[model samples]
Target chain A: MNAPVPGTPEHFIANAKDRVFFAFDRSDLDESAVKTLMGQTAWLKTYPNTKVTVEGHADERGTREYNLALGERRANAVKQFLKAQGIADARVKVISYGKERPAVIGSNEYAWAQNRRAVTVVAK
Target chain B: MIKVLSRAWGRLGAALFAVALGVAGFSGAARAELRIDITRGNVDPIPIAIPAFGGGDEQSSRVGADLAGVLQADLERSGLFRGIDPRAFIQSFASMQVQPRFPDWQAINAQGLVQGRAEVQADGRLRVEFRLWDVFSTQQLKAQAYVTEPGNWRRIAHIIADAVYERLTGESGYFDTRIVYIAENGPATKRIKRLAIMDQDGANHRFLTDGADLVLTPRFSPSLQEITYMSYYNGVPRVYLYNIDSGKRERLGDFPGMTFAPRFSPDGNRVIMSMARGGSSDIYTMDLRTLERRRLTNTPAIDTSPSYSPDSQRIAFNSDRGGNQQLYVMNADGSGVRRISHGAGLYATPVWSPRGDYIAFTKIAQGRFFIGVMKPDGTGERLLSDGYLVEGPTWAPNGRVLMYFRQTPSDSRGRGGDSYLYSIDLTGYNERRVVTPVQASDPAWSPLIP
Candidate 1:
């Protein structure tokens, strides 16, 4: 692999805020999430060949099984936005980690707000 | 056939063990017998005394003492009995034979008394005999004996406790069962959870998996030494079956999509679970024998956590089809679906009790979580325990108790929080922490060891 190309996964992540947040128990994207997904959409458009994985997550409050389904809905929501914004649906794969992987380690609202997120991961 | 089964159980139970002594009928002419109504609230624990068991020899005598200690602990932990201090004894473990003097036990304010003797048989097997007495009425309530491998002594104690609990409470005993749960450690963001099993009293603890992959929501097979749980192995989420005795692990199937919330039917012949595809999930069942898969729910909304009623004729599952996540029940053939949970908050994780009377579930409402149960018809809803976070209620074999996990909130600095298992009486009292080696969650209680 070449060392540090500008259109590589690391480059894309370094240059963009690649994740969006959701309200508790709600998967619908808000205004702020839409604004961020537009940036992710733009990046995917510029790097047309780059395939990205959208990973969904949830806060620690929901049950494991339900959060999984919830995560799927959230990730699918993000993936749909990217596709609607001129990105190909086939280019974006989605998976849900549910509450298994958290963005932060705390149980408070701030940590929960961060944990309930969907991140865009580019392939190596 | 019965003889063959008992002989087989003789080899399978702990070590070489089987009930050698038949239980005598609880006898008393007096109607004023002592009983613990576990279903009622504001009830006091009955004071009971269990002096160490005695023996003809010193070795057996020591073994008896250990057995008595375990028995007492089991009863006290149920929160239906308060163990009377042995130091306040008017009688000693050695002096008491097959029966204890009621006056001696009554003097210590005991409502129940237990006396037993352990002896090593000529074949080197341990033979134990015990009798439970109603102290107030001065009548024998229960008597039984057992012979088992000397090392399988804790099981002997558990069996005795079960016998006595059934006699006094008019309900089956859960003492002889085991608990399987997810043992978690490491950071919150990257918790390493392993499938672990232990005696119901937290003994004989062992981890089945090495935490090589993330495992969650382990549930026991009601009819076998097997469990079904979800694991993210190779970054692909799938439901898997783990044989406890064989130490074998196998994925349930090559499903079309991600699968989770796996549970065995009451008969253990099938596994019911949820599979998600393209952002939608539905309930399903797989016949373990022929590897046949059946879709039980086909709604666009998320439907998961399918649990079979004791009869296996109906299934209770939680779904988001009715807007909010709520409990719904359907026939085994996937017909006549009806929503059972009409509570204000969203409902998830609906597990049917073994007795076929109630379904247990996790309810999230008003910024908190609760472990609750409701009649299968959705009536008689009762929220048992509430905390910052508590979920995953598994029924004890007897259906008189439920085990669930609770998590405490970490401070803003991400410090000071723990997750562990807890059990409560069916009436919502007697809530006690079930001690585990690590922060444990997603507990599933096994059916009573046959």
Candidate 2:
């Protein structure tokens, strides 16, 4: 809706916060999501004292425990990308909620896709 | 008058002939030994007696009576032990505590005796002491003490039964443990599930959370105190760690996909589960200490329900790699994978024996479910019981028996559905139903107390 947040690939490549990002399903980064991650990385650099906990979650179509591991993988994927973008590895921690926590509560595909996401929350 | 006399003469002649045959039969009986075979006794149950615990006032005495009732019911439901009527007692609780007169107990033929005393401590905690005795030998088999809140009198009774069971059977007792299972309350088409836990005997039952979303497959840790289960809270079925004591839970693993069928490693340090991604499931292990995860399987088949050997060096899991579901075993490091089951039916939920001998599993054949066990090498396959739908075979700590869940057949209208938990010896004897208020499934037996 709003103009995509500003920042380029080079800016994110040099910044530590930009290393962490989210991808859609198995797809790599789309252009708009990458720009949004760049903006988040810049904000993280401004608050150097704060740390982040990246929690990954999945949808309810599969088995419970497997979804948990899958969510963890998604969270770690974000952590690795953030580190590559220039964020110190020490500032980010990752956890997987599996399907324990969901943003949408329904049995449809649309709801599931929205639920299968990784979120960054303040840690300590 | 002449006809009647003739009939009497005929009867007398018959009597004389019987006397001659009786003498011959007596001689044959004297030459042969009298042998009576007792291959079976009353499969009814072994009778036991629990005298009311000594020392409690009007209010606390009521608690004691209720506690003993629960213990009696727990033992009876197993169909292994029968509790003697309290009114049949030859001596009162006070006299038995001071001196359990063996002759009095023998008079009633009480094979086992449970006598105890309860006191309200100054700290407001209930201090209960009990002893289990063998009436025949007048020997004290087990003695233990417990301290808990006054409301936990029922738990104290379970502890005593567990002690008595261990002493008499020479095996660890499961009565003191708790069961975390999926409690279903609604219709078959749209059932509501909430995680529920209670004493193994079904006392002090409580729900962990509201049935806000779908929950399934709740399992207890080895210590029998914590729980790990799958919840569809946010539209995803994931594993969640819940501590029974603290009532706090945290998600496990950090994966890019789904995790399910979680079980604690014997040491309680690692979690072995199945992870699904790209429409395929595989086994994986995550170290609780380091948060490092290693994939255990790479095949493109459905691999789920992973369980660990008691020694933690090997794993037993279920896979459809050979076309249909079957059991497989592999090293902890994911090497040396071998198919173990070649049975006729598709097998699922293979749990390694705690004694490290047999693997308990669920077999489905011809639309009927059966609980069975087999050697690790897939030999000696024995189906313990068959039902409309039977699944989730958890072993007793001794490994000599198993407990599983059975779903009853639908009613005439085909609308009523009911299920309950059951336990049976490996020999297929002593099969009995465990009583519970609501329908329960997916039972997991815990190890005996340390």
Please write out the lDDT profile of model 2 over residues B95-205, one tens digit for every residue. 334767767887888877777767677767666667666676566656666656676676567667766666565666667566678787775435677888766777668
Candidate 2 residue spans exceeding 4 A from truth: A1-124, B1-44, B95-97, B121-123, B409-414
* Clash number by candidate, in order: 0, 36
TM-score for model 2?
0.69
Worst 10-residue lDDT window, candidate 2 chain B: B15-24
Q: Could you tell me how far off, in angstroms, the CA of residue B27 lies in candidate 1 after the best superposition?
A: 9.9
lDDT score at residue A52, model 2, on the 0-100 scale: 77
lDDT of 1 by residue, B275-297 (tens): 98877899889999999999988
- Quote the positional error of residue A15 for candidate 1 in Å: 2.6
Against the true structure, what is model 2's DockQ? 0.06
* Residue-level error in angstroms, candidate 2, position A79: 28
* Fnat per predicted structure, each in turn: 0.70, 0.06
CAPRI category for model 1: medium
Q: Which residues of candidate 1, in runs, are more than 4 Å off?
A: A1-3, A85-90, B1-31, B93-99
Clashing pairs for model 1 are none
